[model samples]
Target: MEDTEVREVTTSAAKTNDPDGRRMQLLNYGIQTSIKKCLSAVRYARIEKVLSPIAQSSPEILKQIHKQMECQLQTNIMDEISSMFEEENISGLMNNLDKIIEETSLGPDEQAWRPSGDPSLDVLPHVYSTKLKERSSLEKILKEVEDKNRQLHEALRPRQQRLETLKKDVLKECQYWEEAAGAIPEDYKQKMEKFIRT
Candidate 1:
């Protein structure tokens, strides 16, 4: 009986440690790894599908797209600059150089007023000094104008608000009168019309 029991235990241990079971586990692991690889490949194929159209596009088409994007960017930049100019009230203050030139009668003929040749080094300092004086005077005038504009805006703010309020009140009154008029009896309206005609 001891020998039979020992043989049964050894046989059971051998069955539990079978090489076929290990082989099957290895085969399942290989299959799972291959499935993961296939899924990754499919994802890569999808990415390639999205990129292929752009890659295959003609050069002219690509250039057109680039130009359109560039144009839109330029337009947006111009709009921003225009808004800044307007907000700063600089657009209204800007002098048209061409118009000023025409009004001043400055042309190629006016070049004669300049030195016949390149100005001497000695004259350059005087010219620069004169230009600096003019620029300073212009800047002072601009500062004064800006100050006046700010003061005027401050002064008008209350008046503008009052006007807006008055307008709203007038509208309300008008609406109330319209409703009152609509509610009048037809006979009363006719009587009032007759009285007005008289």
Candidate 2:
């Protein structure tokens, strides 16, 4: 019989309560429960310690520590520069940004060189001429964003097309298993796994 049933019978046999006997019974039950709980808790802690490193290293466990750390570091730096995008402060940023710039010419194989426009096109429009331009309207902001998106799409077009072609080729090669149990032979089904996960 289980512990509770044994304890019930023990109490029934002792028709009268000797305070000492009742106290001892309660103490025994408490000690037994505590021991069992401690053993179970220890098992869980040991298992977690064993699995923690494996889980951390696994690619399937996305948003892992390394990626989150980089994201948080970048977010913090940008947050600290809250006022730098302002019209008056924008000129100040150009000097600091310019200092960080390293000018270099890329050879054909190096692939990084892209020159800006025709020198014969003449005068460039000056920004920060101390004449304040009004803050952009919501419509203008949306239009600028759309135009930038169009440029990004132009740059990504070939890569995106290649990705789609690659996906199709991979899918063509990958064998798709039939999921229906009805399609499986009864002899095999009894001995083998009933389902095969694709």
Candidate 3:
């Protein structure tokens, strides 16, 4: 406990000596953590959203995926999204990033959408549990953007298929009606013609 206290004090003093530097480092770390969590939640939420449609719809797999994200890639992914967001001059707050990105890409779900911008998955681990890096590679930076792009296209594919099926059904219905109308009674046609005031 004494050693922990001493280390914290030293860290505090170093941070106090260069507050701006500390803040920037902190901000970068925060963004990375937040984005990672956001993406993981987004991915899991996607699994949950699309389970019935996809081949493997196990909540266990979803949990495993989320756990893997937190254990391995979450920090790295968040860093990338944060760096990009900062470059775009988007605010780097993590609390809202998850929900904002979720809403931006997935639109909304009935049980989970929050008008205040909070995400639906509260069971996931807390983000922003540590400090941040001040800089990172551009190659490393754009990974999240690409991942997000892929996610959007995937989500749209099923909806597009449904639309195509609907169009085919409607066209078929029209054809059926046309064929039925062609077989109309001769008497009805004669009556319709007489209404022309022959």
TM-score of each: 0.38, 0.20, 0.26
Sort the candidates on lDDT, descending order.
1, 3, 2
Please list the Cα RMSD from the true structure of every candidate, rounded to 1 decimal place: 42.4, 47.4, 33.2
Instruction: Tell me the tens digit of each residue's lDDT in model 1 across 161-190.
Output: 999999999999999999999999999999
Over the stretch 125-148, how does candidate 3's per-residue lDDT look in tens digits?
A: 333232123234444568878898
Error of 1 at 161 (Å): 0.5
Q: Looking at candidate 1, what is the lDDT of residue 13?
A: 47
The TM-score that candidate 1 achieves is 0.38
lDDT of 2 by residue, 67-176 (tens): 56445654564555434435456434544454445335455588753445754432233443322343446567889999999999999999999999999887766634
Top TM-score hit: 1
Q: Model 2, poorest ten-residue lDDT window?
A: 122-131
User: CA lDDT, every prediction?
Assistant: 0.64, 0.56, 0.63
